[model samples]
Target: MKLSLKKIELTPPQILVIGFAAIILAGSALLSLPIASATGKPLSFLNAFFTATSATCVTGLVVVDTGTSFTLFGQIVIILLIQVGGLGFMTMGTLFAFALKKRISLRERLVLQEAMNQGSMEGIVRLIRKVIQYSLTIEAAGALIFSIRWSFDLGQAKGIYYGIWHAVSFFNNAGFDLFGPVTGKFSSLTAYADDPVINIVSMGLIILGGLGFVVISDLLDYRKSRRRLSLHSKVVLSATGILIAVGAVVIFVFEFTNAKTLGTLSWQGKIWAALFQSVTPRTAGANTIDLAGMRQATQFFMILLMFIGASPGSTGGGIKTTTFTTLIGAMIAMIRGKEDIVLFHFRLGKDRILKAITLTMIALFLVIFVAMVLSTTEEHPFLMILFEVTSAFGTVGLTMGLTTDLTDFGKIMIALMMFAGRLGPMTLAYALGPKTEKELYRYPEGKITIG
Candidate 1:
């Protein structure tokens, strides 16, 4: 007698994302119990869920002080949540499957493709392995450097733990920090700022992590052969560099006379703060200066920086550098009456241009809608609402002192934005599953012209 066995199906990306989110929520609830909190007060389930979502999304927006509110175990849970969340749930799932020596299924490859926002599934398995290796290597290096620096500041044991925790935090772009009191205090990083080794190492990790895994893979490949960088890498690197430099210059110019923040700083301190502000807004959520004390113009500038965010396929979130660049390039091309959309000597497809435009519009709309909702529910100014919305959508975690005052509805809205930002609006859309319906008839094209 022949017996047939039924095949088990793997979970879809949406289900997987939700399941992981549930696990994080449950974990946060358990950790928020009286025994796990620093104040010995049990956290409300809503607060715990919000915090869990924020952490899992690698978003730094917190209703409570992470350092003061959570115990060591709770903090560890948040860190782990960030690690998995930053890496993408499917990516971690794939790594576990690989560790078990299990064959990666086609569905898994598709999931990985969606996770990284790659155009193709070819070499996705290899890409996933490389991503894991690269992440570990970078995180380890960051931890080592941080540990060495922290050792000199603190004792060996504390420094070692600090190093490891911060390394994971920075590399993952999760802004949770042990420096609770020092968060808004610029005096905390005074020692580390001058220490070139620590500053450079941390910034280097941030850059590498924010550069996107695709760019890293491309660089690795280019190293073996003296070939040029891929278009994606070129665009990402060039846009990122230009944005950082411009942002730094803008910050330096604007805050040079503030007196409270950058104005009173020495030349070196000013430059360091400016540079940190510029770079950190690229979705790292680490700030050297007091964000609340910045000039309105500077705050607006930061909003733009946070919105543009880091490169695609990276740990950081935003509209992405490439998308911003492409949208600008497309506009320029259109204004010049050019039929072909070309950038870096390569012609961009209409689909790409359309996707970029759509993503930007959707992101903008989401931010605005959430901000409007918050304005109505929370007792904050419109500017503060905008700041909070941008913070959530960018996953930058920098707030203008309004996070704790948000109502339950406002928190949930921001939580949704954070989730969408981290997973990516497009990825979340795709996770709902693609809508594939062929049109039976083509409609007549209508043309309208406007400036």
Candidate 2:
């Protein structure tokens, strides 16, 4: 048989995979340039590749110091990658299309539809516009506040630049920071642990960015509907509120007497630090205190929080808040022996519940597999390995001094984990191979299970 010139069509997942890979490659190439480094020397291939992947994936697990290693040119490249990764290239394309007054075809709409995790193609163009506008508005406000504080420290021009960089970093939930101290390396926000402005602005940006665009749009539309909100909006808001509050309390209780972490702080400072750490680990990677100084129990709990991560369709990575919430609802329904799963007085769909469970299981399997791999490859404590693996899988970027010490293969393992985590476990699974066939035939059901 002779083949004609037929156009090849790619599935949404395939398109997404290709797009992300292309971005990562381009970023790596750019960062490999000598001008990207402050030392006027190009980064090692592996280091550049890892940084590029992390930035493009919006995962901030950098092998090098983001501040001193890279020059202003390199920093700009990283910031651009973060913005594109956080909002997605599809949104960027849509914006460009809008600017050029070009007509968006069905194919473009379909891609945007998948990118936004929307139910349909309606209003997607408009939605992207709103997302850009809203995100910039928030970043501008946050940048202004940060600039005021940093201006006093870094001087006028440098301060504004630093402020913009961090504003973009936090808003994207990318953990990369330029605050590596002259004396203390990779200090993060520890120097300003007692500073209210830095803590509040950073945490607030992370929370808002992690809320997901759909939730933001829902709330914006709520007033028109007599203050009514969608079930998703309500669930996300409730879960986020509960998690932040409970996490703060747990961290405070666990680290209350730990001198290295919280004991040295005054009462108000301790409370603020606890709250900041709690909120940061769930999604964002920035921390006001040294994570290694915290109690082991707090670190363990942080792994759980990191695994759950930010809300679905957000810049942040992990299994997502809704997935965790759905699992909880399912468990509650099972204990009650209810045939239908319910949350917020609405009946939960069976398909959604199955997706949640499957995603979580896949995520758990990935984390454990990586941890075991790291154990063999890295000569670190088992608990620390677990923490690093979970952190990479969640794209949370928080490390227990294990990031820089990873050997060659270990770095690759964590890099792959970060890529998978950024795309999400379920999404990565789907991209690997989605069940495309429909079964019209049904066989008799058989059940045999004992736990």
Candidate 3:
């Protein structure tokens, strides 16, 4: 196939913003069609738009039930959006480009770098190829397992279809689920709270998806070559393990006496639920237990986990594991009266530290501002509003029963929050800002502070 391509003048960040918006809008339109609904009546455009944004952003918050409300076409549309959104539009486009044997232009490479959050254009194309390859293999294995497991209960054909749908959703860190019929509407995976197969598989998919592609690739290569892991991979793994373990412990203790949550489960069930909850908060929205029923302390702890979120270049969103780790490292350096922020015996550059601080600040402000706005627009309690806002900004779908009650204005706000979260607060700032101007001059800095 011969292809003629004209140069696009947009910056990488701008292209990403535009590409994601395009997918969201197109998805919204399709979902609004009568054929997309289970009832054969057109879903309101607002609901359709919200659902599309949630799916494309891979945020699981939903105003409507996924299983009973949509026809097979709508579900298919959603899973496709999740796949494209999770891997990123550029990745899917690159796959097509590879199939067509089209040369990847420098501009396209730049876009890919930004899309994957890679530091350089070098080896970007190769990395993307590995990303797609690894993602498909993982999703296929998950789907086969889910299909076989579900076959006995749902019939072979339904099991297969659901298996594929859920595999895509889970592996993408998108919390969309079709258990609405089996469980109640918006019940998520509560029905499988004690099912080891379901809980284990769901957590496995989420963890793999949350671990960024680069880390995944590095781990795989390390296994083959018996090589030392990259510092980034080491920090990511360390932080991830610590967070999960701590979160599980905290949740287990906090919810142990609460009759509505972990208290009623068997000892083994409680452990599974605790672990699952811990993992899900890192931008994987599938919940095995009732989030609303959990103790407030546990909910707040999960909020912190959600805010730290998944690793960079992964399907999940938030400030990112690396950024959180960097901030903590910087804090430790300050406490120890050291001039350098060190991680794994290596000194971190000022630029990296500054970027981490900037990203966290931007994310924090965005989340706070959105929460304030929702507080005024909706009648929910301040805590619930904050949780909803943080969940949207973190692109984590866990909610305390607030999603269904949101006003139209509130819904739009949450949708925009999800958009910003998925693209990243810093990236959105860059895409919307004027051209960067290099300052040729600098003034001396003076600071006065009291601790």
Candidate 4:
């Protein structure tokens, strides 16, 4: 008798996880090459892996100064990684599939659906094409604005190069910057803190890029379909606006007299810095103010914002605006003794609410657990350690100047956090969990008490 074997198959989520890991590893290998560094010295395995993780995750955390440490060639690689990471690997794969005129298989569409967090597999190819086209167009426009402003400052060729570099970085919400040397290494956008042109353009790109592609698609369909905003678009826009306003106000209130971050600035400069700081911390890692100088209250507030992060299907990471809003909806419904979680006069599915809860719980668990691990490895202030862990978990790269001092083990811990942050707590869970299960029997329900 002949023996029979079963074929192995990967779930969409598992494929996504594997795909991102594969890309990060490849990027790490390339970045570790001697030619990839400005000093002609290749980064050690840990550093290279950290940088690649930062780039591929679009988290903007760096072990080395991107500008002073990497050559133009290396910078290009980093930006390319950001581009791939920002748009997501599957989104790019679909675009390339279209470019090659290859038929997108059903499995490929399913992967794209999962990657994009879409409701269905329908029109995934077209959606990806739109995402790529819109992304490039927006990035090009941003680059042009930057280049025009810097043409005389840095000369045409170099200015254009710098402009394009930052445009990509800004749109991707990756805070890796070449805007250093004049001030301090890894100084970020502090040198141009008061430059309205740079600040406005970069912030605009960050906001637009952070807005989920679904929202963009819905907006574009408005004129053609004559339909109102999708529920998701409405929730994301409303929450994003409120969060930004609240964050700016809180930052302004806390740092008005700190004399380090928002203080001591010209009145106009203060407002701009405050607003920029408020916006950037929410998944955009660029900073015009010293985060370390801000009060604990302000930093803690920012940790909340970072934990909420960008909306789903956007370049930036976090539990997501939808998840946050859903939790609130669930709470409100419970308080009112309502059976359904209603939002904007729409009843959300129980499954979605449960998922939101699950993601949040897992995220909190990861943050607390990792922070504890970090506390053991380093002798930093507890709040600072918590801040760093939350930042990594949110994929927001703002640090309290503690990233460079981390031990090897600490670096690994943060890297893991960044990876988990980018993939998402639930994504990691599902990706690593069993691929399939059959539940043919039901068990008696048990009630649990809650405060």
Best by lDDT: 3
What candidate 3 gets wrong by more than 4 Å, as runs, is 1-8
Alpha-carbon RMSD, candidate 3: 3.2
Query: Residue 130, candidate 2: how far off, in angstroms?
Result: 1.4
What's each prediction's TM-score?
Answer: 0.93, 0.97, 0.97, 0.97
Q: What lDDT would candidate 2 get against the real structure? A: 0.88
Comparing 1 and 3 by lDDT, which wins?
Answer: 3
Per residue, candidate 2 scores C-alpha lDDT tens digits across 169-248 of 99999888998753257788888888889989999999999999888888888889899999999999999999999999
Residue 397 of model 3, lDDT score? 94
Query: Model 2 TM-score?
Result: 0.97
Per-candidate Cα lDDT values, in order, are 0.82, 0.88, 0.93, 0.88
Clash counts for all predictions? 0, 0, 0, 0
RMSD of each: 3.2, 1.6, 3.2, 1.7
In model 4, state the lDDT of residue 317. 88
How well is each residue in 243-321 modelled by candidate 4, as lDDT tens digits? 8898888988889998988778988888889889888877789899888888999988898999999999898889998
| Superposed model 2: Cα runs more than 4 Å off | 1-6, 181-183
Give the 10-residue window scoring lowest on summed lDDT in candidate 3. Answer: 292-301
Can you tell me which runs of candidate 4 are displaced by over 4 Å?
A: 1-6
